[model samples]
Target: MIDFKVLSDYAATFTHSENDLLRQMEEKAAEIYIPIMQPSAMAFLQQLIRWRSARKILELGTAIGYSSIRMALAAGNDTTIVSVERDEAMIEEATQNIEALNLQERIQIVAGDATDDLSEVASAAPYDLILIDAAKVQYEHLFEKCSGLLADQGIIVTDNVFFHGLVCDIDAVQKKQLHRLVKKVDAFNHFLSEREDFDTIFLTVGDGMAVSTKRSCAEGER
Candidate 1:
């Protein structure tokens, strides 16, 4: 196919404006150039969890804990979040943020490469919801690793699947700053679409988001 992206109801995707906390922190992250999920996307995530009745949530990136915190608060008392971040500094800030929210018991932050040794993080696996927003090239690896960790009815939601619209035609974006990202997202999308274990849907949102659910998993897998 010429276009890697299938047309989606752009208007209906996690559609909502920024809330107060989202607006304020988004400004702060911008001041420091600390990337976080857009408010609209977070808003959608909130809807997603509520609709999916998410009980356990796993996040691949914890840039400033903005989205993590948002997800936790929106999930309420029953939900627990385990977010992974590679950067030490980011982890420190996220730790403090989690504590400040009095969510130390509800949210856990792990420090280390998310893909390097998931064996440790795997303890939190079989998650009902998994949100990935870290390194672009590792999307496929994360998906595979997280698959066995997902519950039967779990969903894996990934952000930045478009990579600034480059995923559609890497030849044109190969020379751009986002060339590698575009190529990787395309690779991940291609890999997922062919898999029978999961049902995947790619939506064009902030950068882009792909929501996949574990369908009939392969033999010897969950």
Candidate 2:
């Protein structure tokens, strides 16, 4: 396998730099030991939002609001994003960041468990895009809950499915403490791949990402 980190860094060199606010937010996340979206994954997400002309977005994680900000910026001024974060501290930080960027109207942060908060998210349903970057173990449950909330033509993008490349390496799993997590992620990957209602592709980008588009009912029936 190629060194994806090296290639991802090289690819980022050609892309434009994030604004000073986002740059500072990224620094803050790093200083706090909070993980944010990788550059390659962030770029992919931005492109997806722009290509889909996403108007309503739902994000499962707001980790310092880095990815949410990127998505909002990419989708333009009219788009609205409802992001969820379980941690109150992260919510506070993310809210501050979003407000500082003058995007309070465009992005709303919900503070609660994804399972519980998703019910609130459903009120804004038929979202053009749903981003899942929350707990690795709850991915399948999150997908199930959010799938019904998606627009017929909408797309779902999940991050960190690879879980640091542990999903694909059985030997590493047996030797490490990530057996349960690796198992769950692997199962989630398989579940997504086999879903009849959606067409899914797993990519080798940042920690691996899975992009799934809901198939038409007729197409799914076949």
How many clashes in candidate 2? 0
Q: In model 1, how many backbone clashes occur?
A: 1
Q: Candidate 1 on 31-69: residue-level lDDT in tens?
A: 977878755567778889888889799999998788888
lDDT of each: 0.79, 0.86
Candidate 2 weakest ten by summed lDDT = 168-177
The most accurate candidate by lDDT is 2
Looking at model 1, the pairs that clash are: 126-149
Least well predicted 10-residue stretch by lDDT in candidate 1:
3-12
Estimate the overall C-alpha local distance difference test score of candidate 2.
Answer: 0.86
Per-residue error for 212 in candidate 2, Å, reads 0.2
Question: For candidate 1, what is the TM-score?
Answer: 0.85
For all candidates, the clash counts are: 1, 0
